[model samples]
Target: MDLKSTVASIVDWPIEGVIFRDLTTLMKNPEALRESCDIFYERYKDKNIDKVVGIDARGFVFGAVLAYKLGVGFIPVRKKGKLPADTIEESYSLEYGSGTLEMHKDSLDVGDKVVIVDDLIATGGTAGATVNLVKKLGAEIVECAFLIELPDLKGRERLNGCKMFAMMEFDGE
Candidate 1:
């Protein structure tokens, strides 16, 4: 299926001049959602990933399922103060604005391989912050995966050389 066609485009959301690529529409469809998870599963089934670190909210949906399929652990990178344990945080800038993301301090160990998952990559702020948090805990980032990528924002540049993949691309208009 054309996954991009399954996504909804909401113009000027969360702020003016910013187009939001809403994945909920795709997620609501059984075929689309299953295809998304299957794509990631097929890619990482043999990568020996120790954990799937999903960004707050949307990331959790795909990350958890992928982790289960890969038989690995799942870690959550949430907004600051959401995790109730010793945690590390990184601040980032998104197309909409800026925010801080946090993850448990003990989520990973040195040399642990992880894949950071999210719904989309826009300004790359959220993914970048999550990458920092994973690196801070001494984990090795296998790759950052997203369902959609907005190239116009140059979010991938913010990843600092880490490898990344997106199932679909959307123009930033």
Candidate 2:
């Protein structure tokens, strides 16, 4: 139900020249959140998704839910050392600086198919890093999905080896 309108935009948040797409407004609305999940559900329910790999933090909210709805396992791609087991990491650049993301070494296996889910895609650094991490495990990325996308940030340009989908997109201010 017009989820884009439910999202909030905070200009220059946590950094300058970056308009943060805050999903909390949409998260706080039952109907909006339900619709958002339902959109992902309807798209992937029939696909072969062995796991829904969620990016750290914000991605967990929708990624876990989508995995549950799709009847697949949920895997979290967290920050360095966050996972208890042996892990592999992919360092990436952020708007302000650089950071790293990690996934358990045994979390995925060769030939497995997965969908990378997150709250948003902006400047694509994290998504690109996650894609590389999945590749290292020899898994096939079915697709990447997001609730929101900022085309102005050109995040999609940095991603590779997967189709991308989003529920809502905010561009050109």
Candidate 3:
């Protein structure tokens, strides 16, 4: 569906010398959105994912829907204090410094298979933190999925030994 073309390129977004790949344009188009979701669903439908862990905000958009489509539960990996119940938190480095993320303490059982989802993969810090949180809960991460990947940042390197998938890849400003 050429989903990348549907995404808007924003120069110097959120910071200087950084180009943001905005999904709002692609998400607003029904065809592209549906196709993107369908592609993810089809790929992981047979992976027996017990839970789909979405990392905050945008991840929740497709993560919840993807979980429903696969008949699994959705676990939110949010910023600290967002979840009401007891939660497990992990702090990781960001491009500038550090940030933290949390998930419900009981969100996954021992040996439960999970797939982490997000809108994009940048430097892999967030995804790596999320993976650690899932492991600490005694759950196994089967795969990581994203809508877009900035290959130049080598985000996938932080996910060594874990299966990862993405719909599109870009190396740009």
Top-lDDT structure, candidate number? 1
Ordered by TM-score, highest first, the candidates read 1, 2, 3
Error of 3 at 154 (Å): 1.3
Prediction RMSDs, each to the true structure? 0.8, 1.0, 1.1
What lDDT does each candidate get? 0.93, 0.90, 0.89
Q: Give me the runs in candidate 1 sitting further than 4 Å from their true place.
A: none
lDDT of 2 by residue, 1-173 (tens): 88999998899887887788899999999999999999998999888889999999889999999999988899999988789999999999966778999999999989999999999998899999999999999989989999988888888887875789988789959
- Sort all candidates by lDDT, best to worst: 1, 2, 3
- Per-residue CA lDDT of candidate 3, range 93-168, in tens? 8554578999988899999999999999989989989998988988988899999999988888887568899999
- Which of 1 and 3 is the better model by lDDT? 1
Candidate 2 TM-score, C-alpha based: 0.97
Predicted candidate 1 versus true structure: per-residue lDDT over 1-173, tens digit per residue: 98889999998887888788899999999999999999999999999999999999999999999999999999999999899999888999887678999999899999999999999998899999998889888999999999999999899999988999999999856
After TM-score superposition, the amount by which residue 20's alpha carbon in candidate 2 deviates from its true location, in angstroms, is 0.9
Best by TM-score: 1
Displacement of the residue 18 alpha carbon in candidate 2, Å: 1.6
Listed in order, each prediction's TM-score against the native is 0.98, 0.97, 0.96
What is the lDDT, from 0 to 100, of the residue 93 in candidate 2? 95
